[model samples]
Target: MSNMQHELQHLPASAGLEARTVGRVGIVGASSTGIGIAIQLLDAGVPVTFYEADAAALGAGLAQIRSAWTDTHDSRLALLAGTINFHHLKDADLVVDASETEGGEALFRRLDQTTKPGAILATAAAGAGVDRLAGATRRHGEVLGLRVDRAQVWELVPGRDTSDPTLATVGALARRLHAPAAARR
Candidate 1:
């Protein structure tokens, strides 16, 4: 067998399975940040679903995403990368909020009522009051904040309820995304 095949044979069963399983990711916004993240996730072989509140905004975001890909290539081959959407957040294993507008609060409230009980919810907002947002939506234990600046990422857990299992899952996902963890404060 080839060296590649030999290496695959020695991989753990879970590792082998994970290599074949495509992860589903949901982004609650379709703005620049959201679409950028979706592109990264797609590059990592994850399927993406985007939810946007405005139809015009969604169209704009899609155009921007396509433009970015096209700008980097001749025929815009990345257009065929993965799936994307502009409405509805349904049955997603992981959901990320990339909007810093009041929409973030509204999205969290809707997610609290609609998302699966154990689904992971994350935010890229640096200074947004994640704990307060969670408390307002009655999801204090389920929300996690991710801070990203200059390519450095940190996970922020609320001090009041930092030991929740959901936080651990979020941390694991962050690790999978190659993000570093920060202490809760």
Candidate 2:
């Protein structure tokens, strides 16, 4: 097998971070950050639903994802990557808020109501107030905030009630994308 395939097959599994546990995921935005997160999850055999308000933006974002793939990457991306609406998000186990901090609170509140119980809500907003966002939801215990710039260090700031399981889940996902990305503070 090629090195990339070998590496993926040999990825050291973190205890309690069961790949199956993190089921279907829904990402709020369809930009580079959102697509990057989807890639990370889809590469691990996780299903993803990309949510973009603008149909043109969704088409563009999907094109970007398709362009990034090579013959070597998993073929399942073709099936794993797709679009969905807010009503379809109730089945998602994790909902990532990849939008910039422009009216993010309202979005978070909406997600809180739409997502099923125990589903984690993650924000890709850089240095944003995750605690305040979580305050808008009753599932504050399932909220986590982290950012990835592909250029700088990041902080995995847990909200006021973010549970250990939620932190571990996001931490495992972060490690998969960039190992040793310590969740400082």
Candidate 3:
């Protein structure tokens, strides 16, 4: 398995984030972390749209998302069933890219063009150059990086161009996820 998958496999059951009301979320890359986030968001009542360049990869991600909820004895499959779309991504309230794949970059670019100006765009790239990505996109101020690990919850990694409003929004989302609020300086 990939490092991303291995990392997600060891995530603590209570990473401090409880799924709250996520309205609409778009995930790119469909890696282990990507699929995990999609499932968690959907279980929390958010509708999710996933974008994958490979049909088989998309299918696998859908299956993974379903399996996570299924094995947990959560019977929200009916609600979560139709809540997931395995096709082209549409405008969503929030968008998360699990890796620094080209597909993720493309989706970020597209979202930069079409999504509402205030939409949240987060990346799960721990070491990727977030500043460069933000620079290449249209919504520089709204972009942020998220780092997650087994022992802790989401950590916001600020991009060079990130703004205060973006940080505030990230805090709100983290709260909604039941994750600890980002430490304020």
My TM-score estimates for the predictions, one after another, are 0.67, 0.78, 0.72
Ranked by lDDT from best down, the candidates are: 2, 3, 1
Task: Evaluate model 1: give its lDDT.
Answer: 0.58
> Can you tell me which runs of candidate 3 are displaced by over 4 Å?
1-22, 71-88, 100-107, 181-185
Give a tens-digit lDDT track for model 1, residues 2-73.
533442333222232222122566777665678777665655555667777677777777666667554566
| Ranking of all predicted structures according to TM-score, beginning with the best and ending with the worst | 2, 3, 1
TM-score of 3: 0.72
Tens-digit lDDT track of model 3 for 1-185: 65434433333332334433336777776687787766666656666777766778778777777887536656545434322343334457677787446445665676687666567788886676677778768888778777665533666777777776666655556555555434222
Query: Per-residue CA lDDT of candidate 2, range 97-167, in tens?
Result: 88643547798899988988888888888766888889888888888786665643234667767776776
Q: Any residue pairs clashing in model 3, and if so which?
A: none
Ten contiguous residues with the weakest lDDT in model 1: 11-20
Which residues of candidate 1, in runs, are more than 4 Å off? Answer: 1-22, 68-87, 150-154, 179-185
